[model samples]
Target: MPLKLYKKRYEDIIHSDLIDRKKNLKLIQLMMDMESAFSIPMIKNEAWNERNKDVIQFFQQVSNSRRL
Candidate 1:
């Protein structure tokens, strides 16, 4: 079933499926692998978009500070 197909509330899953924490971890890993293999790189040509600017700057500042 698609993740969207789950009809349970978020709390329901937290209380029930969370019992299988290892399985949830594996699902998350699988999603990451699939996304990296299939996703296209966004050129992000709209550098002036305010939210994008914030995100880009945040990462840039993080990297620069980490190097120090």
Candidate 2:
């Protein structure tokens, strides 16, 4: 589900009095913020491919030098 939906659900839960809002408010907000932070795309496929290519070239160069 999208973050908005989760945020709404969290708001409802917080206001439902099922938990201590004053004490757990910070914790709940932190959890939501963390979820938002982590949901972003942190990895780039292009960067991964470039790194792999460099590694493969390094290995090939090492093997070629060993053979010579």
Show where candidate 1 strays beyond 4 Å. Answer: 1-19, 40-68
**TM per candidate:** 0.31, 0.31
Task: Please list the C-alpha lDDT of all candidates, in the order they appear.
Answer: 0.38, 0.44
Superposed by TM-score, candidate 2 places the C-alpha of residue 10 at a distance from the truth, in angstroms, of 1.7
Model 2 C-alpha lDDT versus the unseen true structure: 0.44
The all-Cα superposition gives candidate 2 an RMSD in Å to the true structure of: 19.8
lDDT by residue for model 2 (25-67), tens: 5434545453455442235455544655543343233233221
Which residue pairs show backbone clashes in model 1?
A: none
Per-residue lDDT value at 15 in model 1: 50
Show model 2 residue runs off by greater than 4 Å. Answer: 21-37, 40-68
TM-score of 2: 0.31
State the local distance difference test value for candidate 1.
0.38
Residue pairs in collision within model 2: none
